[model samples]
Target chain A: MPNASEPPTTSPGIVRRFWWRSGQRTRLAVACAGVLGALAVTGAAGFSGDARLAERGGPGVAVHRGDSFEVTVRAVSGVDLFEGVEPGTGRVFGARVAGVSAAPCWQSQSLAVAENLLRGKKVRLIVKKDGDTGTDRLLVDVELPDGTDYARTVVDEGTASADVAARGELGPVESAARLQRRGLWAGGCTGYRDDALAPPSSTPQTSSTTAVPTTTTTTPPPVPTTTTEEPAPEPPPTATEEPGDDEWLARFEGKRCLLEGTRRTSPKGTEIVCTRGPRGQLRWQRAD
Target chain B: MRTEDHVDLFAEAVEADPAPTRVDGGRPRGLTAEGWVRTTGWLQVGDHPVSSVLLAAVAGLLWALVGAAALVTEFPVAAGVLTLTTPVVSGVLWWLFTTRLRPASTARNVDTCRADELEPGDTIRLHGSIGPIGQVVEVALDDDARVVLHGGARRTWARDDVVHLAELLR
Candidate 1:
């Protein structure tokens, strides 16, 4: 097929020529080995974006638009899902199970319960928009596969207590767990209801019991005792009554005080003084 | 064809007539990214001969598939496998292009002769392996080997390894 007048067709040399004649499978295998090795080297060297993203372990903020999404639990810290002890960074958004607070006295044990129950399990996340600030911790009802509320389960398991501050009907479940002497409740751990009764201690007081209600003198009376039966009552109307002149010109009560420590005599001859009330609001109080 | 004709045919297939002062493949050249890509990309390293530009577009597509799989969590297990494998496969394809496949395609483009036929003062590729067009130095015969200047040092290559010799043209 070659013209004698034209120069010879150059051979690619023995090895290359032999390679050229090699079977398709051998060439393909060699190609695969080289490529896979290069990728593994690149990943090991930290050059790939995928490797970087995986190392970071997902995003700090959950990128979702709707009221709910789904996620597999990566970790559990205290009562929050995917939240490390430190704030933000290398986390998949801070989420706390709605309606339950981890029992302060048994926080480590509660974390263990949560980790055992939720780790690597897929759960439906129902975001509570009203409970969230849109930036920080998101209030979510973590629902397991069978539509069971994870927070309620924790409360039932006695690892966590029902929180009046969060929305849920978990008070009765917590009460039942305590009455049955389950989990932390077996040792009479302080529940959220008990914490409200004796508010001074930052750590849950293990010795706190029904006897706390009898020590009303040492206990602040402002705490709503009916919190278990009803929603907490509105903060009692502050007793710092304004001078009444605005309501009825006949009396100088329920009116703002002119100056703190100032004293005035009412039309009925009752003495009133401007002083700071229990709520720190400077107002008129009967000096009698 | 007769036996003599077969012999002539085989000889012609292997060796080119020595021309005095071959116009090309006799001088040193500069390396560039574009030149490297041309020699390494496309189906240059494979049995398939395709334009490097076309192959680059295909590689870009593969990268997109891989990137999408990595970024989107909703993607299924198949997508995960695709993300894990595409890069290595692409790398292998590239390696094949640069080292083995591309050379097979473009080898005949340069002036070549059996290493035993090389004369003194005849410039040839410093190393016999197909790679970035390397240094071109004048070679001299030393017994059964070809001697060439490499990195300011004279090194001799066995004629068997340097079975065929060519000079860097570009």
Candidate 2:
């Protein structure tokens, strides 16, 4: 650590000028203090953090009445023969999968189910047995609010009464099982691998010849929306830190406003046309 | 005229309007580069709450930003930017403050031309938003010797523009 009295010995010319002008110690100290303060806030929030107790979605997992989405409940990881916990059944420690985790996991694991079942209110995906109950986990889709009009589910639970099939492919156990019944299942295990992934099998895709047009069309639209949305948002928190650098905050604080939706008007009759920010919350007295 | 002649003209125009009143908002009321440029303390800027708020905001915001930036990124340019901005922002802010707060100075305009009536270099009271909202440029006389009023925006108007102002005082 450099001391204040030491005068910050460094490479003399431009480098030294840069550090001095930058208020090196002051800035670093402030930044560190801010980070530490944020960490403290996070810890405080953890105590208040609500952890949803998810119920595993079972075979009879009720799908919502209308509007479609995916739900995933971890099935198993390692087989527990000694404990009588079946390869794909028995008590599974539940981790709730809501609309957030459902859509992605479904698309990645079961493309067919993702395409077809995802369009309906209820989506179910099952792959062949991977290894054991402890190592491999099952995912389930469940209805929300009993008779649902498509709402997001956070924590869902159900009984594990699912079909057990050959340890063939790494696709959804129940799905691969159904595919087994039809003899149409293609991709199962990945070739020449000891690890319990998929078996030696062809790609699950049917009509693989016209790969050009389908790949071309589906990739672009969602990428931009998803990429732009991924950045750390400036906290959409309902309550905000009180009045920071923005001077105009005072002008609107505790005042109701009917923002023309076109422009923000100041209390003193100054119409400010801007979209970026007043940089803080403006209290307003809504005009009607 | 030099490149700064336009600025010099503005300075002169404003200075002519009220020389003793144009206080630099950057430095303290009394403290100039020369140090302790005293004020009479009558028209202290603190009298207006709005002006004080504008002053505090302009100064504190700039400095606090410098402080925050130095705290966050620790870039060399932050301080440099702040130093260059202090005076410029202060001047602009002061202009804003005064434009809204300062009462317009009075100037007189009369059409009657008597030999002993209106003395040269004499200050006169004029009734209008002109003296209050904008500064008065130097008074000029055209070829006909008709008195013409010059305003801040370079607009020249004769006594004909003032129907009520001339007739009411008549």
Report the number of clashing residue pairs per model.
Answer: 13, 50
Categorize the docking of model 1: incorrect
lDDT of 2 by residue, A1-288 (tens): 111110111223553334323432453565456545644554444322211111221221222223233333233221110111112322322212222222212222333222211222222322222222223233322332234311121101000102222211213332322222211111222111112223113323212221223223332112111123233233233332222324444544354221222234332344433232364422343223
Report per-candidate TM-score of chain A alone: 0.43, 0.17
- Tell me the tens digit of each residue's lDDT in model 2 across B13-91: 4333331122231322221222111211011122221232343344444454544343322234655666566546665
**DockQ for candidate 2:** 0.00
Residue range A67-96, candidate 1, lDDT tens digits: 776767776767555532212222354566
Q: What's the C-alpha lDDT at position B168 in model 1? A: 31
- Predictions: Cα RMSD each: 19.3, 31.3
* TM-scores for all predictions: 0.39, 0.18
> Cα deviation in Å at residue B29, candidate 1?
5.4
